[model samples]
Target: MTDRKLALAAWESLFRAQHEVFHDMLADFDGTDISQAEYDVMLTVTRSPDMTARLRDITANMLISQPSVSRLVDRMVTNGLVTKCADPDDGRGSLITATDAGARAFRAVATVHGRSIAERMSALDDDELRTLRALSDKLRRS
Candidate 1:
């Protein structure tokens, strides 16, 4: 194949692989208090100190758009999963913190999801996983 064709083929393969893996992993959220998106946001929040993060930071980390993330965070607030407050440092910006309930829910789901991810990814050896991670990071940087 020509270089362009080869690149297209590689992209297609990567996209399909991601879709399949994501679809399978999404099942782990079934019967959980949070959807995949909420879990994603909570994951970032939980990783931060005191389970708090700026809304902009969360938006930066999430794949969703800023408006969508704002709406989602509002829903999460309504569901008692998290709290949204004005950023003390920046009045125009907002801060998000996972509630105790949210933390509990995240922990409950994370245990299962983490294992599921590991099991699914086990098909790739450590070196392959590392290479994949590096390549993904490179792509994101680019």
Candidate 2:
């Protein structure tokens, strides 16, 4: 193969391996009784620092439908991980918020999952880590 073709093949293989690694990390997260989808929502909500997110915003960020967002929020609330409340700014709309319990659970999951990931990547030296980050950023931009 040409040099460019060989490089492209290596990138594809690494990307697939990265996907598998993510799948493994998500296999056991129980925070909010969340699937990968719900946990993603939770992360976005919690990071916003407003302590709340609109249903529409969540749907947009999650790339899900309104009905699907509602269902996911309902399930999380039932599991004591989230709360759904009418938006004060617009009573017709709703917002989703994570409870204290939800934050705690998310933290716990992050701890375990982060440790597993760190351990796995520990073998890579600092230069390898930098290369990985640069490649990830490049792919994301592309």
Candidate 3:
């Protein structure tokens, strides 16, 4: 049996916590060459083999709409942070690859961002983190 009141309370707490944490973490991007969105895009791209990823894959991983991702990718390309080209296998799709400059920028911000995340998450113990991860994953899956 599920308690509706309890569930709603839990959801409200979770949402508020996430919002606050995200807001605080926004500082990590300040003075960086790339915005958070660009970092997110490159996070997907650099993780892929050869530092390349399908545009569709990037779009899938992002929270923004497909058209927004396309526009952002174009801006990234113009800034020389990444290269974009038509996908070889999918004529209608595109591929995004991080340029050397882009990779460097990502690494720099990632180092600072990783530290910031660790510091913030230190509020929870390792076991709590594992539990949080599991619960978050379960929610996403559901």
Instruction: State which candidate has the highest lDDT.
Output: 3
Q: What is the alpha-carbon RMSD of candidate 2 to the true structure?
A: 3.7
Cα lDDT of model 3 by residue, 1-142, tens digit: 8899999999999999999999999999999999999999999999999999999999999999999999999999999999999998999999999999999999999999999999999999999999999999999999
lDDT of 2 by residue, 52-84 (tens): 888778887876777888888888899888888
Name the better of 2 and 3 by TM-score: 3
Instruction: Give the per-residue lDDT of model 1 (tens digit) for 1-142.
Output: 5599888999999999999999989899999999999999999999999999999999999999999999999999999999999999998899999999999999999999999999999999999999999999998898
Please give the lDDT score at residue 9 for candidate 3: 98
Estimate the TM-score for candidate 1: 0.96
Worst 10 residues of 3 by lDDT: 79-88
The candidate that achieves the highest TM-score relative to the unseen native structure: 3
- The C-alpha stretches of model 1 lying farther than 4 A from their native spots are none
Identify the runs in model 2 with alpha carbons over 4 angstroms from their true place. Answer: 1-4, 30-34, 55-70, 86-94
- Candidate 1, poorest ten consecutive residues by summed lDDT: 1-10
Best-first order by lDDT:
3, 1, 2
TM-score of every model versus the real structure: 0.96, 0.71, 0.98
Clashing pairs in 1: none
